[model samples]
Target: MVTERLPAKISEKSEEKKIAPASPIGIFDSGVGGLTVLAEIMRQLPNEDVIYIADSARVPYGGRPPEEIIKINQELIPYLIDQGVKLIIMACGTSSSIAYPVLKDKYKVHIIGLIEPGVRAALSATRSGTIGVIATAGTIHSQAYQKTLQSMKKTGLPAGREIKIAAEACPLFVPLIEGGFIETEETRKVAKEYLKPLLKEEIDTLILGCTHYPHLVKVLNALTGGKVVLVDPAEEAVAEAKGLLQKAGTMKGKTFPPRYEYLVTGSVAQFQDVGSRLLGKLITHARQARLPTPERSDGGQVHLPLK
Candidate 1:
């Protein structure tokens, strides 16, 4: 058996001390998409304080360059850490695929992303070795899903079952959903078109690679004819997050209302409105903020207003 060695820095943290039990959990997505994950986290860990950031100004990271996605994550994670969060969740699929590897090494606190958990869930649910992944273009192009599944197969488990992956980049799905088209005929049509190939490949499990993608769960479930197990990363990821909080002694022992904070580099009112509708919470406030200007040389910061 081969054992993977932890980096010296990570070992130092565990050896030195665990995160403060009461510290808030920080979570960020390119935009409102992460609220899906946030909703799940809240459901499972209601008493834990949470600070969520929606980088709505830079919404829809599906087709962005890898460097741009990582740069944005670089800004978001550090800001969350500066707010004294004990843990961070990369709630965007594109960021999970492209940015997590680069940013995880730079941070001291535990950073969790959607990919590995999504991969594990897909693996566990699949009776046949074929898996279907539907995510953003950036995520699919990064090949994160395929790589993780194949790596697991190499671990010599499941003896004769070989994992095969079929990934599709559904670039327009996010826009469709964010535009309030979920459960609409337009959404159904687009989703069916996006899912056709995977169904054709006889996938027994479909991984909803994007956090935003889960908002279309009913649409996807119906389209897949209820024959396929829909593996949602948020569900699996939050389960692991619960264990981590417990290990760090951060799991709330008694039920108490915990503070929930929201921030965004976009329209505050808009984020609050849409956030409230999607998250099942009255999001009364969202602070307008800025990421360091993307073009450092020019200092031309992009401030996008959420629609």
Candidate 2:
């Protein structure tokens, strides 16, 4: 998939500049997990303003139907646009897999997804030729990671070796982490069961395909015996965003105020609570915002909502 980075939409006034570096980069995810991506952006692109939206009211997008994932994004995109985001990041794997294709071509603003970055990172890191992917059912079913790897393998890598991939849908991981189940026996048990097939595949590298999976690292490492490398797409995704901004000469670069904005479609209290934990700091402000209920292209309303 092509991850395009463009200038935010400009006012139609002919005299107006086409680009604005001061516009915040927008990021949206099903819940707190995308904070992993946001944390990396803060660390790597400190100068740029960032706005994050947590669709926490309907948090777990994993098992939902593809159309429903796109439906939720219908609510997300316009909110970010109203926030004056120059670029939007689909930090949720489920949305990236299902909604991205729908939005990338349709939206005028730049949109980037988490899948290709994770795939590329895993490809670059794996030496044993075997890689395992753990993600939401929607992501796995969509085969975004699988397709990425397959495309790379089809052309062959510099090493000229075939790559092996094992994809598993850890549908429960997102909810467990959202519920604060990390580092517990409950988590470990779940990890073992979910990772069993991949372990048997003898994969040397694992892609933490869901952003939420990063917090479950301790359990994942224990389950994988710490020998398998874990690829977190957060870093790679941010790296790509940074590079794009650099090429645009859009780095905020000490000239602007710290404009880290946070919004949610869920309870502000819960959003702040889980987001603060993932972000490793006190998230002082989070406001709830209502989104439009999605409708069909034919002008009918979409009635599905998943948690």
Q: Per-residue CA lDDT of candidate 2, range 1-307, in tens?
A: 1111212232322231244788889898878889899889889988888888877667678877888888677666755675667778888888888888777876666788988888888888888789999999889999988988888764435656888899999988987888777788888888899999999999999998888899888788888789999999989989998888888887777886667877776567877777787678898777665554432332332333443
User: lDDT, candidate 1, residue 114?
Assistant: 90
Candidates in order, TM-scores: namely 0.87, 0.87
lDDT of 2: 0.79
For candidate 1, give the lDDT: 0.79
Q: Model 1 segments beyond 4 Å from truth?
A: 1-19, 154-157, 294-307
Error of 1 at 214 (Å): 0.5
lDDT, each prediction:
0.79, 0.79
